[model samples]
Target: MRRTGPTTVTPVKDTGPPGRGLLYGLGRACARHPWRVIGVWLLVLLAAVAADRAWGGSYADDFDLSGTPSRTGSDLLNAHGAAGSRGVAAQIVVRSDAGPLSAHRDTLTAAGQRLTALPDVISVAAPLDTAGAVTDDGRTGYYTVRFRENPAQFEKSYVGRVDAAVRALRADDVTVEYGGPLGQLARPAAADRASEAIGIGTAVLVLLLGFGSVAAAGFPLLTAVIGLLAGLSVLGLLASRYAFAAASPTLATMMGLGVGLDYSLFLVTRHRKLLHSAEGPVEATARTVATSGRAVLVAALTVTAALAGLFASGVDFIGMLGVAAGTTVLVGALAALTLTPALLGLAGRRIDRWHVRTPVDEPDDSGDIWHRWAATVRRRPWTFLLLGLLGLGVLGAPAAALRLGHVDAGASPVSYTERRAYDLVADGFGPGADGPLTVVVTLDKDHRTTGAQRDALARALRDALTATPGVAAATPPKATEDGALLVSTVTPDTGPQARATTALVHRLEDDVLPGVLSEEGATGYLTGTTAAQQDFRDILADRLPVVVGVVVAAAFVLLLAVFRSPLVALKAAVLNLLSITASFGVVVAVFQWGWGSRLFGIDETVPVESYVPMMMFAIVFGLSMDYEIFLLSRVRETWLETRDNHRSVAVGLAGTARVITCAALIMTSVFLAFLLSTSVVIKMLALGLGVSVVLDATVVRLLLVPAAMYLLDEANWWIPRWLDRLLPRLDPEGSRGRAESTGAAVPAGRVTR
Candidate 1:
């Protein structure tokens, strides 16, 4: 590697604040032993990949709903041997063009037998034997197949066997489709290869334009790819140990790429600035790490902290998703701190060697467009602040009407087997049949009712359910072998995830079942896939407030400690909250109101996924803080020197605005690319996150922040002396340099004038 400038002979000491001290030491070590660090990272990557390939488990949708009625009912059913295991239940639909399916009884029987023989299949109930399996038309029919395990936990090869078994029934006049969990397995993989490609391509283009150097552009992308790979490998390993949602890795990838690229970009930008002063590569790298690297570290921790706060949601699966995403962020930060510096050392001056054109020097900010904009904002603070607030308020208005619920297979495209199966079942047996609610009755041990009396009571309960307002039908009760449990399947008139269905579930839990069963010395639990989903939604809604409180409080405290100014931290929290709400509003409008839904491939209005708001708040809040820190750090440095609030605000905004804008664009592009995802949840997340970044960067960071600081004047930096003394010094900008001294404050009034 070609050396950029003279090497520093003096040894660097760890005498700064703890964060900077740690980063400086790490930088020196990596710079001195670049080869060793690189080699070690390579080995780790390999080991992670190898281990994942050998032992890693695939993502699944299994959730631990312990203490919920669903769990109780599932356990009771399993113990009573009413169903196969507590595994997944699927549907195999067959439609014959020739005539009624009953005419092809022999073929249907053989198909059912073949399905039962498939790997992991616990049992298959033939349409010929099962009631409600065939439509009134008699041309369409379905068989219920039960698996020994969740289909998500089954090997990919098992899906092929299922397809083959179903295909065997596909005659020239017949069409077969798989539904339920099996259909979910057959659905196109949710991973968006195109989105990943487009995101990286866009990042490369943006980086090149910003840096004017191909090598500088490539470095961030390369580091992010490595970090993402490592993160996902670990995620795969984690999935083996614990059940993670199928979207976990995808979520991790999105977060990992955004943070990884942005972190490296910060460090690289600082390095370039130091290089202009003729600092040697090693010294410059150390200083960059000490300064921008510290900022990266704090920002990463803030994000991780916010994500970890999801644990407060009281849903293990949602919390695990947060953990999965946080794991990637942690890995990305580690890479930015260590792997990036090592690579910088290896590249030396060659970091810019691959430029398509001569790399432009970092520009002076005094007369820049951002500085002029800041000057404009300072001139009319109230006007800008009002405009910013109004825009955010309008955008966030729709959030007032936000409805949280799960999306059903009916929302998926008809091309998907699960969706087709769902449609067939709906068309034949009514939408309610797609998600029947099982009423599980467990009798009191001391009940005086004999088996015959219990039977009469079950029949009465069934009649009552059938007479219920929203119930379409109620099956005759079936007792467990031990006679301790009785289950009656109740089909609602509405589809699962429909508002009416949710209402019916609550009704059964609160009124109908209790009114009928309580007098009989028995308790009824409404449990099934649909009921469990409703319960999950309820849990998310109940816990969302706690999760938001924890995340916001944590962020506020961290910001307060860092800035030593309560006003600054409070302003940040409030602004971030505004941005998040605005983003939520957009999600509600587009997704729930069906406004421009087709632009993102959504065919119908759907309830916002219940967990989306909580997850988005944590993520967007942390990200909004990232830009806040970057902007305010510069502003604080300028304020300390000039003691002129307006000047400091202008200078700070001018200095960091360009980089922050570029970073936000990069992050937004990364998130928006996920719009192509097949999963509605992923699409919702992508749009919400992308919009939040744009609004935060342009509206909040640029307009609101500057205007607020200008209005607050000296108050922006005010902190009680006692509090200042008590708080640890957190210099986001390292101690290597100071802003040029301007004359001390004229009186505060005079300075403002």
Candidate 2:
């Protein structure tokens, strides 16, 4: 079936050869005990589900600032009874259309009484009880219901009870809305079942088209889902030990599902090809595991290590997110390694029995379309390289203008109680009322400081804060019970999400507070939800580069070890960075610049969520390695046989491009399907991940990488001889099998695959 080409293409000589050891043994052993392996996997899935229901932790956006100034200040105040230790509060903005809020006093009181009696609520302060809680219009006001435990600490049904308790406040003439963390908890749960169905459906369609067999299509989906569900359960347990963000699980799901399927797909693709060789099912399964499974393992390890490197950033939340996502990927790989072989064993030679059509013919020889494309590139490396660079440059240009900040509730969907609360609060008070800064000033416990000096400093601080450039108002300083601390509320002229608001926080902390407090031996800290979020943004942005450096270095070392070529490792790192830049640019354009933001349910333009870029970098970098390793493994495998880089690149591109393209399509579909999530944050993650996979698979893998290697020629595989000895070799393609493959060039009955 081999076609004559512009040039001859060298085959792998030894590919998926049964002589490959270790992984082959694992696969054969599992295949021989198919029922036992299947049973064990089933038990694992069951245990994971049961464990989550019994002892799983809660999910919330609990960004704990352990050593940050705001956290330190807040902790001191809470310890000294300056900050309310009454626990978390649900802020309710109330509006009356018929008359002033006074007209609805009885209803408000009843609502408060019911809330106070509700489970976990520690106290309730109705607007009428708290002076200044009502606005000047007298028609709008707010109240607080303090709960003993944070909302996530409660069961899901608890939200229903709170909803019922506040029903009286939502009459024809009155309305109630939830704000702050409470608002986050109050938002309706997004059902991802639809998205999951769509992803599976798309995967099935793609599998059928490629494999042309119904039975062959289902195993990948089944194993992926099994691994994913179990992995998710594990993440829930991790949430108990670590405070991961609310979006953590969704992010994990997105990664787990994509990788889980792709890993399984590779194994099954190899197994099916082996089966067609008329080899016994057990032998074919073993060879498939030895060959394709080794690639999956290396790819998985590389990804896990890269994600773990996120810890280098020194941000626990970011690092934990990486851990969360990495866990799923690890588990997914485990499933593929053990479970896929068992499934293959169960199916035997009948994998094609439930046929939809003959499987698509994939040409692995040098004369196929991808081979010709690679040949064309090899002949004109500069043109292909420049074209790829042009495309990537155009896509990534928007990243230069990325703006990172908190996404306020004002950006939440209108259907969310949080958004309604944000709007009502802004209208009733000022735009900044929803995110007031709490200035906590603590004087040293000295007689002079506690006396006239303390009074003088507090006065000066109040004067300076109110006169500050962005300040709209500042409340008079109120002393705590010990009189050791003074707390004041500072409102900015702009909303909490505005750049001006962040500038104001920095201005006060750096200049205004220091100027007054230093004279009195006092320390002033900006301690409030708004200020804490600003701290989060600043910390993450500052550490972005550290994370990038860690991930890139980790990848370079990994590639260098696997391929034993410094240039190959460096090319992969650079190409991965290009993929990330393009993806980040797309996210910036859609979410920050609002260039069709509405398509993703964003109502208005907003700053890119502060942590999004860092998270994206770590994830995209790891994922890009999957394909990088896949292609490079084959190229290296071929090079070891012939020591010819040009023929190896061409043959590798022709051989793997079909599977990689199909795999990219499947992964992209999974990521894109998550766009159905109501959370704007999740949608942003979906688009970024999806776009990255597409661009990386096409522009980078199909164009830039091959072109670069073509131009580099034999230099691509040259490693400094001294360093080569120091580097450990991890041949993902089984070197032992190469001796067996030399006899036939390629296994009989193997087509373009």
Q: What C-alpha lDDT do the candidate models reach, one value each?
A: 0.82, 0.83
Per-model C-alpha RMSD? 6.2, 4.9
lDDT of 1 by residue, 253-298 (tens): 8999998998888888777777755357887788778777878888
Which clashing pairs does model 2 show? Answer: 362-752, 362-753, 363-752, 364-752
For candidate 1, what's the RMSD? 6.2
TM-score of 1: 0.92
Error of 1 at 190 (Å): 3.2
Segments in model 2 whose C-alpha atoms lie over 4 Å from true places? 1-20, 83-86, 276-278, 445-451, 736-753
lDDT of 2 by residue, 489-521 (tens): 898888988878888999999999998788777
Native-vs-model 1 lDDT?
A: 0.82
Residue 483 of model 1, lDDT score: 77
For candidate 2, the 10 contiguous residues with the lowest summed lDDT are 744-753
Error of model 2, residue 556, in angstroms = 1.3
